[model samples]
Target: MTTMTAPAQRFREFRMPDVGEGLTEAEILKWYVAVGDTVTDGQVICEVETAKAAVELPIPYDGVVSEIRFGEGTTVDVGTPIIVVDAGGDGAAGSADSGGSAGSAGVAASEPPAVQTPAPEAPPAEPKRQAVLVGYGVAPSATTRRPRKQAAPDVPAPDVPTADVPTAAVPAQAAELNGHDRAAAVDRPLAKPPVRKLAKELGIDLATVVPTGPNGVVTREDIRAAAAPPAALPPVTAAPEPLAATAGARETRIPIKGVRKATAQAMVTSAFTAPHVTEFVTFDITRTMKLVQELKEDRAFTGVRVGPLLLVAKALLVALKRHPEANAAWDEAAQEIVHKSYVNLGIAAATPRGLIVPNIKDAHDKTLPELAAALGELVATARDGKTSPAAMQGGTVTITNVGVFGVDTGTPILNPGESAILAFGAIKLQPWVHKGKVKPRQVTTLALSFDHRLVDGELGSRVLADVAAILEQPKRLLTWG
Candidate 1:
C-alpha cells in the first residue's frame, strides 16, 4: 500500500536586516502586526529606531506570525529575529541581497486556496547581505527566540457574506489583513501619523474638519489650515478650557530606556572621564564647491556622489598625517596613547530618534572615488538604519556634518574614546573679500572638539586650520594629499 504521508511543515526565521550605519540593535517602537496575524511579503510589519532614523521594517515572507522575540522599547543587538511568520510550506525566507534589502518574492503559487508545501529534501541557502552592523555579533543564530501565542488559532470559518454587503466585498481576504480594524476610523478621513499626532497635539478633531486630499487624507498643510479654523480668527481661544489647561499639567514622563537611556549613560561616562576642549573656525568654502562640481563631472567619479563633505573628510585625513596625535586615542588604563596609521572616519548623522555616528574604515587612504562612495554609503546606510556595530567602532576620528541643516558652525563633543571630532557647517553664498574685493562666494564654518588632556589647543588648532586651509584653497588639497 503506497499511502504517502505529508511531509512535516518546515519554517525559516528571517533575522533583522542591517538597517544602515553599523547599528547593533534597534528598539521596536511600534508593532504593525500581532501573533497569528497574516502578513504579505514587503508589507511593513513594525517601526524600529536606529541611531539615525525610525524605519518601518517589512516582512520578507508572507505568512501568519508565530512569535515576536523583543517587545516595544527593547533595543536588541543585530541578528535577533524579532518576528516570526509562517511563510507557507516551502517558500524560503533568509538573508537579502547585498543592498541590505530583503527581496524574496515568495512563491506566488503558494497563495490562494492552496497552502505552501515544503519539499522534504532541501539545502540550507543563506541570503546575500548588503550593509554591515556594528557592536553586534557577526553571525546570527538560525533558530528563532521562542514561539508565542499569537491572538489565537484563527477559526477556519467557511466563506460567508454579511447582510446587505455583496459577495465581492469580503474579498477572500486573509484573517489578519492590516488596517481591517482601522478601516472604519480611517474611512471618514485620513492623515499621516505625524499629521495625526499634530492634530492630536493641537486639540483638533480630525473627523470634524473638512479634508482636502485625493483620498481625503489630511496633509500637513491641511492640519495647519485646520489649526487656523477661520481665516481671520486664531485657532486657539483666549480662555483656557479644563482639558487644554490640564493637558500640560499632567507631567508625561518617558522612562530613560533603549537608545535614549544608552546614549545618556555613554555621554555621561565620556564627558566625566575625558577632559574636553572645543574650538571653531569660520572659512569661505567657495573653492570647495567649485572643486566638488568638477569632480561630479569627471569620468573618474562617474557613479560617485560629490559633495562638500567629501572635501572636508579628505582634508581631515591629510591633517591627521601632519598631526598624528589628533588621530590617536587616549587609553587611560593602559597609560599609553595608541597612534593608528589608518584612519576610520566617523560621521555623526541625526536620525528621527537621536544621533548615530557610523564610520568609514581606512578612509585616509581611499581615492576621491573611493572616498565619495564610502561617504555616500555611510550617510545612506545611517539614514536607512542599517549600519553595523563593527563598522561604527574602531573610529580614530569623526566628522559631524551639521552644515546640511543650515547651521553656520557648532562645537561638537568628541565621540567617546576618540581624541578629536569635527563639525562641518552649511555652505552659503555670502559677500566675502576675495583678492581684496567684495565678492559673492560660498562660505562655511568648522568646529573641532578634542580631549584637552591628550590634544592641546595648539595641536587641535593646527589640525583644524590645516583642514580649513585645504577647503579655502581647493588646489592645496591636491598638493597636500
Candidate 2:
C-alpha cells in the first residue's frame, strides 16, 4: 500500500530586541501584522516605545504569522519571544486533499510534534540564532525577578464569641471587611507596573481601590476615581443635577511616563548636581535682525530657514570656539575637567511629547547655510516625534529659545553633563541708546548659565560678552568666526 506523508513544519520565533542603550523593557505601541498574514524580511512589523524614544522593529525573515504573544500596549521584557512564524509548512490545500486514511495518519504524525513543542520551556539542545535588525539585538540573558519578602506569620485572633461565624471562615470575613478576598489580602495586588506607579503617585492604596478591568485587574481610571473626593449632595429643595456633569470635572491626572518622565528626572539631576551661575546681558540685536532679513532673501540660503535662532546658534558656536573651556563636562567620578575641542550645539525643541534637545554635530565646522539647514532638519524631526536617542547624546553646549514664547529673559538650567546653556529672550522694538542717541531698536536679553565648577565668573562673563558682541555687530561673525 502507498502511504501519503506530510512535510515537517518549521517555526521561527522573534524576540523583543533592546532598541535603546540597555533598555530592559518596551511598551508595544502597535502591531502591523496579525496571525495568518504573510510578512517578508525587513518589513516593519511593530513599533515600541522605550524610555528614550519610539522605535519601529522590522521582521528579519519571511513567513506567515502563526501567533503574537503579546497584545498592543503591553510592556514586554527584552529577549522574550513576541511572535511566532510558520516558515516551512504545507499549504492548507495539502490538508484538504488528504483522504480519510491520510488524514488519520497526518493527525498521528502531528501528536509527536505537539508533544515536542513544550521543549521550549526547557533548554534547547542547540541554540538557534537568526538575523536581527541593525543597531539592536536580542539580549541572551532572561529577566530575573527579585525574591518576594516572606510574609509575617498570621497571629491568632483573640478569643471572641461569634455564634453565626464559623472559626474557619473568620479570616475570610476579616479580608472582606478590608475590601479584598482572603487570597488577595495576603498576596500583592493585581495591577500592571504603570498602574502601580500611578497609584503610588496619587497616594491611593491599591487594596482599597475597586478594580474595574479585565480579569479583576486595577486600572489607571480606577485609581483616579478612588482619589477623587466624594461629591457633596444637593439639598432636597434644590433641583437635581445630572451625574455625568460633575464626574471628573475638577481635576485630571496625567500618568507621567515616556519623554516627560525622562525629562523631569534629567532636570532634577542637573539642578541639584551642578552649581549653576547665570549671567544676563541685554543688548541691541538690531544688526542681527537686519542680517536675518538679508539672509532670508539671499540666494545661498534659499529653501533653508533663516531666523534669529539660527544666528543665535551661530553666535553660540563662535563663542564656544573662543572659549573652549565652556564647551566641556565635569567628570565627577574621575574628579577632573574634560574639555571638548568640537562643539555639538544642542537646540532645545519643545514638542507635544515634551522638551527634547537634539544637537547639531560639529556645529563649529559648519558654515552659516549648513548650520541653518541642520537646524531646520532637527526642528522638523523633533516635531514629528522621530528623533532617535543617538541624536540627543554627547552634546557639549545647549541653547533654549524662550523668546519663541514671547517671554523676556529668564535663567535657564544647564543640561546634564554639559557645561553651559544659553537662553535667548524675546526681540522687541524697545527704546535703546544706540550710537549715543535714544531710538527704537530691536533688542533682546541673553542669559548664560554655566557650571561654576568648570567655568568661573570671569570665564562665564567672557563667553556671554562674546555672544552679545557678535549679535550687536553682526560683522564680527566674519572676523571672529
Candidate 3:
C-alpha cells in the first residue's frame, strides 16, 4: 500500500530591525503589503518611526506573505517577529521517509504524523542571519523572548468547609470573582507586551480590569480606564482632569512618542545640565542683506538659494575659525573638553515630526556656494521629513533662524552635546546709526548661547562680536575669512 504525504510548510519570519543605532523599539507607521500578497526580495514592506527618524523597512527575501504579526501604529521591540512569509519547499517530505520503512509507514499515517511533530520546534534552531535587510543587520543571537510565567499547581481543598463556602464549589467561586476560569487566573493576562508594561507602570492589576477587546483580550484603553478614578465620587478639592477622558472632551491628548518624545527628553537634559549664558547683539546688517541680493543675481549662485541665513552661516563658520575653542564639547564622563578640529555645523529645522537639527558635515571645508546648496538641501529634506539620523549626529555648533517666523530675538538653548548655538533674528528696516547718522537701515539681532563650563565670558563675547562685525561690514568676510 502506498501512503501519500503532504507538502511541508516553510515559513520565514522577519523581525523589526534596529534601523537606527541601538534603537530598542519602533512604531509601525504603515504597512505597504498585506497577507496573501506575493513579495520579492528587497521590497519595501512597511515604514517605522524610531526616536530619531522615520525609516522604511524592506523584506529581505522572496515569498508569499503569510501573516502580519503587528498592525499599523503598534510599537514593536527589536528582534520581535513582525511578519511571516511562506517560502515554498518540500524538504520535510523527504525527512518523513528517512525514519520509517514501508511496514511502519502505515502505522505513521494512522498515528500522529511523526515527521510534522518537530516542525514547531525547528524554528529555534534555524539561523536568523538570513532575516536581515541590506544596511540594518540584526545579530543572530540578539533575538530574546520574555519568559512565560508558569501556571500554579492545583492545591488540595481543606477537609472542613466553612458555612459560607463549600470545597466542591471553590474553583467556580474563584472563577466568578475574577471573571475568568481558575486555571486562567493563575496564567498570565491576555494582553500584548506593551499593554502589560503599561498596566504594570500604572499600578493596575490586569485581572481586575474588564476585557473589552475581541477574544477577551485587555487593551491599552482598558488599562487607562481602570486607572482612572470613578466619576461618581464627589469633587473634593478640585482634582485635575484625566488625560484620557471620555469622548467629546475639552482637551485632546497626543501620545508622546517618536521624535517629539525624544526631543522633550533631550531638551530637559540640556536645560538642567548645561550652564547657559546668552549674549545678544543688535547691529545694522544692511551690508550683509545687500550682499544676499547681489549673490542672488550672481551667476556663481545660479540654481542655489542665496539668503541672509546663508551669509549668517558663513559668518559663523568664519567666527569659529577665529575662535576654535568655542566649537568644543564638554566630555563629562571622561572629565575632559574635546576640542574638535572640524566643524559639523547644525541647522535647526522644524519639521512636521518635530524640531530636528541635521548638520552639514565638514562645514568649515565647504565654500560659500557649497554652503548655500547644503543649507537649501537640508531645509528641503527636513520639510519633506526625509532627514536621516546620521545627519543629526556629531554637531559641534548650531544655528536657529528664528527670523523665518518673524520673531525679533530670543535666547535659544544649546543643542545637546554642543557648546554653542546662535539665534538669528528678523532683519527689518529699523532706525539705526549707520555712518554717523540715525537712518532707516536693515537691522537684526543675534543671540549667542554658550555652555559656560567650556566657553567663558571672554570667549563667548569674542565669538558673538566676530559674527556681528562680519554682518555689519560684509567686506570682513573676505578680509578676516
Best by TM-score: 3
Ranking by TM-score: 3, 2, 1
Please give the TM-score that candidate 2 achieves against the real structure.
0.70
Best by lDDT: 3
**Residue range 84-125, candidate 2, lDDT tens digits:** 778765433455466665664566566767523334244323
Model 1 lDDT tens row, 27-63: 7788888888888867888877665446677765667
Using all chains and alpha carbons, the TM-scores for the candidates as numbered come to: 0.57, 0.70, 0.73
Per-residue lDDT of 316-356 in model 3, one digit per residue for the tens? Answer: 99999999999999999999999999999999999888999
- Residue 97 lDDT (model 3): 58
Error of 2 at 434 (Å): 1.3
* Model 2 misplaced regions, further than 4 Å: 1-9, 89-136, 139-248
Clashing pairs in 2: none
Clashes of each: 27, 0, 0
lDDT for residue 58 in candidate 1, whole number 0-100: 72
